[model samples]
Target chain A: MNPLRPIGAAFLRFLEATGRLSEFTAVAVSHCVRPPFYFRLLLRQMIEIGYYSLPVVGLTTLFTGMVLALQSYTGFSRFSAQGALPYVVVLSMTRELAPVLAGLMVAGRIGAAMAAEIGTMRVTEQIDALATLSTNPHKYLIAPRLIAGLTMLPLLVLVGDVIGVFGGYVISIYKLGFNPGIYLKSTWQHLEFMDVFSGVVKAAVFGFIVALMGCYNGYHSRGGAQGVGAATTNAVVSASIMILISNYIITELFFAK
Target chain B: MSAPSNPVPKIRIRNLCKRFGSNVVLDGVDLDIATGESVVVIGGSGSGKSVLLKCILGLLEPDDGIIEVDGLSAIGLGAGEREAVNRKFGMLFQSAALFDSLKVWENVAFGLIQGGRMDRIQAREIAFAKLADVGLKAEVGELWPAELSGGMKKRVGLARAIATTPEIVFFDEPTTGLDPIMSDVINDLIAKCVRELGATALSITHDMASARKISDRIAMLYKGRIVWNGPTAEIDRSGNDYVDQFIHGRAEGPIRMEVRAP
Candidate 1:
């Protein structure tokens, strides 16, 4: 009944969970690098995580860029700095908004699906069946998804970057009465390669985080339907939080003086 | 020489123990199955029956035990060796546990294509043959597991279990939710498949009818220990109170159900 005992017990539980997650991640990564890779499974997961996610990532970033342009215009006009509109739109879309927003959106869609599917498999004993059938669940189930996330998120974000900047361009030229050629020129002038590179790097890390959380939570899920539901919720929440946290760390590493 | 004085058992388990925190599940379980023998461990729900099967299957490690398959120790084997050992094993889960993402044929062919590395076309043919063996039509193999009836799913699961032609097959509560006629059908099919393959068979169930039908021998698990072991023909006369209570489905017995008033 000691108050300090409860805190110590909770701390121990946290440390145990962190250790288990780290081991799971290490094993998953090791399997990814090992032989007998399931190319078909990898292709299927890529299509699921990347290609299927295009429309949502596209629409989200496009609208984000549009709203960002309007907000930047309102703020810049106060100081008579409206010429910075294109620069702001392009830089923000490439460096931060596109990757983060696409990440969060994809985390909601793909992360939840992976967790629910794997968790259901766990609860149903299909994962144990996989083991009995001489297939390693980590290799057969987890590694492909992990590989897909690492590769596909950056690609999705890159597409998002272009679409988002285009959204801004459309808004500035049509709504703000700016010349199209001038706006395009200003966007190109302000965008450094490092800006896009850093974002793509962040996107890759975010993708890995999303997939890792999904697989880790799902793989360890026990009990039944409610356990799977909990796993799915945890997957999305953890992935979203990790994305935001890693985004800042990566941004700081790239941009900090 | 005809044979060694003591031929090694296909599967030999001794002093098996497992505990989840303070709740002990399996407590010193001992069993031996000769090659090509069919043995069923009968127990009520939550009696660590499934845990016993999982431990032998290497899905769950027992805190203390010796599990030997074909005279070789199975505990703590390396991944490659474990996979090699497990390749000879197939299982039919209580729920059938089909991969919902895959078609029925794919589910059946999974062990073949994944474990045996047999090409899909070859595996599909073998899958169809196994499905036919279980009294399923070839057309049934194309449908999703979700589209299947409860009985059909069990049949498909039986088909998957026998598809690899495994040396040992484990069935986990094979007839749990099926109707009587369907249950008997699955039971007969299980017996037929195990006999045809000449495989050692192990199953865990509370279904006395299923135990009698498919098992050559029956072992009754009570309080995580094998309370009785004998031929299925002798189960009715075992003279064990637990067996008597279990077989008769009686409420009054030495074994109490822990039911509390709400």
Candidate 2:
């Protein structure tokens, strides 16, 4: 009884936490659709979530694209299939690396930021002050972030797609001795609209998940400074993992055949 | 002075009960405040004074109670109803709780712009006027909350509380982190603000000086109930041992604080 007691309690706690997260997500999303929208707050968050996140997301996907071109050349050279390099770089960048890498990078940046900001507010009782001011915290704090995440990620993914493909072009033409015109031609010829579309869709979903986890962890944070630190770490880690998991699920949905 | 034949009080609580896990915070407490009156609830840390204020503000729900505000039931209100009730209230939290993201004037103007749906230009004008009332200059309103000193933050918080001229105002530890001089300044501001606006005021403080200065009547909360309540002039001679020990700040008394770990 003693040996199993701890495990049973741990499992129960996990279930309870999961239930709370689900309920929190539901309330946050519901508030996002309701009236009394704070458009100024929404615009502020768009600048915070999308524009400010560009440099990090751009750099990550660009480097990943460049590295993919170089590595694919090295591996395919052995099989005498080095002609597939451009196709591989374009397809992978649009379908996988652009959205997933961008998601993870933004999760690391925005997730930690949202958690720290909201967590500090929680500890300082600013959230309670909002309640007293006749404002709903869900509508004021969570909804704008959710809307920004939903609307901005697709744009971010599109920008990532361009930068990533350009990166692959730069490496292939300048470093790999491939002709610039042919490389660009092959990349464009092989790329379909669905490839970019799917990644953008994934970006939107990843954005929602990232912002939701950030807000949820921060809103529920208590204690003080240490609690805010834990919430920040939890926001980044959980958002990154959820991005990976959802990427696979989304990819399977798009191209399971 | 509260007679059975009198009209309804501005605020009333009957048999309020709130428990947190196994630790009971409030237990069957009843109290009343008349219109335009100042009432202060005094208690030490963990005595649930904050919890009582949160319950009244609709930030926390009491397990069971009847809370009447302005002669209307304020318990278990729906979201729209709760917001409606909350329109009449303003709170100054322990740390001032100013929104760090906003400029001082924006923080003060938040209730007017967000809740009242007033135009931003008009709200900013009101916010600056309120800031001036709290002895802050118009330039001070442009700075963010982080730039302000502790005392300045409390003043800004006070300005925000009275920005809309709310009918009811709550001061939660209004002088918690200030020096003696600053604490006295805040108490004076609170008294002046409540009086000038003719607002009903309720405050919770462990600072005896704050209680004595701001409140017309004082109540001491012990073990989640009102142990003593009377006019501020009578606090020193209230004769209740708990009140006696608290007012005098003596370590020995009927209140044996649980100094050890739970």
Candidate 3:
């Protein structure tokens, strides 16, 4: 095998995929703006993407906050810096952990579900049926999911932020023998509006990325059951990686001084 | 089955071609369906009958061709124009393609509610009426498609196909998976629905019995082209070796099954 040839082919495939993705995204985003909103479908997707995911996201963020406080306390106490634990916990939860962790979790749950569901629909010719019925699949299927993802994730992350901070508070006050009043006061004092706002903004973008990847991979999936399996894997894996990549990018946008 | 003098075909396909990479599905195929006519394209699996059906419905873009439906050119239609052309069509997929998420009635009423701009109550009533015409009960309409039997699913699909009384209907291998008795039942219902609506019908099937039952005319596709086309009554005597081989299900004729290399 020629080294350059494989690299060239892989590069060409990447470019081709990027072009297809751009086209799909353009059409889907355009459909999101148009009329015939299909409000009922949007509502259903909201429940699926947001409401049903509350418990899981809540648990993930809560546990993460607890772990963060524990780790920070252990690290800070060695340098007589235990006073900074609450500040660090709250800042991390609001600015980075809440959005990133929650985004990764939703990417796993919603992204995989969307891919598997739509991939099965593709294999079954339901997408073709939708087209034949004078319905644009982008409008009917992908647009609703995108809207739900965009709107609901910020809501999820907001809840995640609150739960995570509360988790840190619980661990700091009860488990670490810190005063509850001091922990609460310290957590609130340094958690700025910008920190939370940037995370929420990141949530919106991450949500869009998850749904977009799910819809894109599922929409383009072919072959059959194995193909659907591949799409599901690709959706979750890609959404998670994109969330990580974009988290850093958005953080730089927000906090790079 | 001869065309009436000066008849304008409701659906006209000329020099239609579609390809996937190196594999050609439809290659310069030509056919016409007269108004209110039932034409079944018969071919083995992978012979591209489904691709031909998809091209006519505007579901698959042909690499090249002219498809005129009801005197409107179908090729290269903008999204709006494509939707306009698609509104004239109703398709029944092999698995009935029922929206398992929707109730039986919602599946039946989809086109009316979505395409015809009809309200739910009105659409449901029409849906029920169509369901009844296809021998389904109102109670059955309340149930989800998953709750229905295979035969019931096909009936619901037929109800959906005629829900809006489309100008043309497509059945994609309508009886492929059903048992013999159920297949016959579906074939009968499809014929009745197409006849009652006076809609032009283009169906793809490999099942000869179903084809003969539902179609007035049969077109045989082989190697991405229409090999022979004539009335169903004359299919047995078409005298073309390929048609004779296909219709008789004999392996000893001119058609050779391509066994892929190991």
Best by lDDT: 1
Docking level of model 2: high
Q: What's the TM-score of each model vs. the native?
A: 0.98, 0.96, 0.97
Model 1: per-residue Cα lDDT over B1-262, one tens digit each:
0111347998999999999999999999999988888899998888889999999989888899899999999999877898999988989999999999999999999999999999999999999999999999999999999999999999999999989999999999999999999999999999888888888899999999999998888998888999999988998899999999999999999888978979
**Candidate 1 RMSD to the real structure:** 1.8
Question: Clashes in each model (backbone N, CA, C under 3 Å)?
Answer: 0, 0, 0
The pairs that clash in candidate 3 are none
How close to the true structure is residue B27 of candidate 2, measured as C-alpha lDDT? 96
Superposition TM-score, candidate 3 onto the true structure:
0.97
**Native contacts conserved, per model:** 0.86, 0.80, 0.75
- By DockQ, the better pick of 2 and 3 is 2
| Candidates, ranked, DockQ | 1, 2, 3
The alpha-carbon RMSD values of the candidates against the true structure, listed in the order shown, are 1.8, 2.0, 1.6
* Better model by TM-score: candidate 1 vs candidate 3: 1
Per-residue error for A44 in candidate 2, Å, reads 1.4
Off by over 4 Å in 1: B1-6
Candidate 3, which CAPRI tier? medium
Q: Give me the displacement of residue A28 in model 2, in angstroms.
A: 1.3
Q: Write the per-residue lDDT of candidate 3 for residues B1-262, one digit (tens) a residue.
A: 2233437789888999899999998988999889878899998889999888888777788999899987778887888788888898988988888886899999999988877779999999999999899888789989998899888988898888889888789998888779999899898888888877778899999999999999889999999999999998999899899999998899798788888869
Candidates 1 and 2 compared: the better one by TM-score is 1
